[model samples]
Target: MRLRRHSLPEPRIQSKHTGMLQRFYNDVVLALGHGCGSSHLAGWRRCPPALTIICALTLGLSCKVHAQAAGNDADNANNTPAAPTCLPDGSGSLKARLSGAVQAELVWGNEGTECTGAVRPDGGIRVRFSHKDGVDGGRLVLLFGIAALREGQSAKALPVNVTVIREGLGEFYSTQGDNKCTLDEVRQEPLVGIPHRSRSYRIIARGFCTHPARAVRGNGVILLPRFDYVGRIDFDAEDKDETLEGGAMTAQGRMKQQ
Candidate 1:
């Protein structure tokens, strides 16, 4: 008795999506005997169950890999760092006029400007104002050696040193050896709306130079007749030598003065 040969019907893909993954799935199906010449249907008929299971698993794994790649791209975008900005609060400003060798009027506000202050280990204060344009634009530094300053307290006629630096000009100090400028009025108060572990205060000061700041390297002088600013100081700022012993001569001497 002669047996008649029968061929299985070709597998059907219903989805019309033409993505790379879809094409890859179609290739995988064809490689598994969907279309491998006249005997293709015969091979699929022999192992339809096994080939169907493999196609399902391959589609699932491809989808998972694509989803994982998309997730990684999103995470990389989120990890990018933000750019630095000026202080948001409207509490920082510096205004001053320079004359003599260097003549220019300087004004800095919270926009495109930054102010920082720290209390030195010797109980002095250092405040700096930097503009977005860098030193060429303008930079001012004030040093106060009035020992310990208390909140809500005001002082007058104290020795204060000033430094001015700008582009096209060299650094200028109030005096080569001694403070030639005076802090006519200075007041301190707690800064509001900011949380800090250590004591922080807003320092407001106005002053004038008794003698112009002489250039560090040249025979130029910058006379700042009047200047004022609003700055901040943190008492617990780190010092140069963090391990100064209590019995250290400098520490003891400061204690004795206190």
Candidate 2:
């Protein structure tokens, strides 16, 4: 298959510099013409002054051309985008690989609970996940918030579907709608049996008032977050809204199971 080539945008010229050069060129030409006219009335047999003016005019035109060329070069330099940098191995820049399961917890923006329909006094939290190796596929175990409040009882894990959009920056996943499950709660949970791949991965979670099954539709990535790595996750529903609308994004990290 043939790859298509796209045209780049034209470089912008600096208005101030362009105007200055234009004015300089006009002044030089006018000076040359004025001097030539004055020299013609000097009573000289030959118009020696006019000839000298001609030479000066020619030099000025050359200088203007040179200046334009230099300006174009500068414009082109400024317009070029910087190339992407390659990450080094074992750089300690990212600690994605963990020995076991990563915990997911709620951090902010909790209005209510989906299961019990109880009003949440405190808001929910957003969860974020970062890992070495790209997060390919994973299972999520969702539990109700009030259930965890009971003595000697843990929140039950509900089945969930996962999809990752951006590699390292984050993945999108769906969970059952509950006010207690804040973005931070989702980020602090563990993602079990995820296949390992090479790349840094970032996972962020947000809970909406919608059902988890409804959120998994279309193209989205999912993974549970643990308490340790969940602190880095940020909760902003506006971002989730964009993803829901199929917005474009660029990733600064990658994730996979170790």
Top-lDDT structure, candidate number? 1
Q: In each prediction, how many residue pairs overlap at the backbone (N, C-alpha, C within less than 3 A)?
A: 1, 57
What tens digits encode model 2's per-residue C-alpha lDDT throughout 49-129?
656765686677668878888999999989975432212121111112111122223322211111111112233222222
What is the Å distance of residue 75 in model 2 from its true position?
6.0
Report the Cα lDDT for residue 100, model 1: 73
Task: Give per-model TM-scores.
Answer: 0.56, 0.30
Model 1 TM = 0.56
Positional deviation of residue 25's Cα in model 1 after best superposition, in angstroms? 5.2
Consecutive 10-residue window with the lowest summed lDDT within model 1: 241-250
lDDT of 1 by residue, 97-209 (tens): 87876676778776656666666565566666655444365444433334435534678877776665553343434353236778788987776544454467777898888
Where model 1 places Cα greater than 4 Å from the true spot, the runs are 1-88, 133-152, 167-172, 176-179, 192-198, 238-258
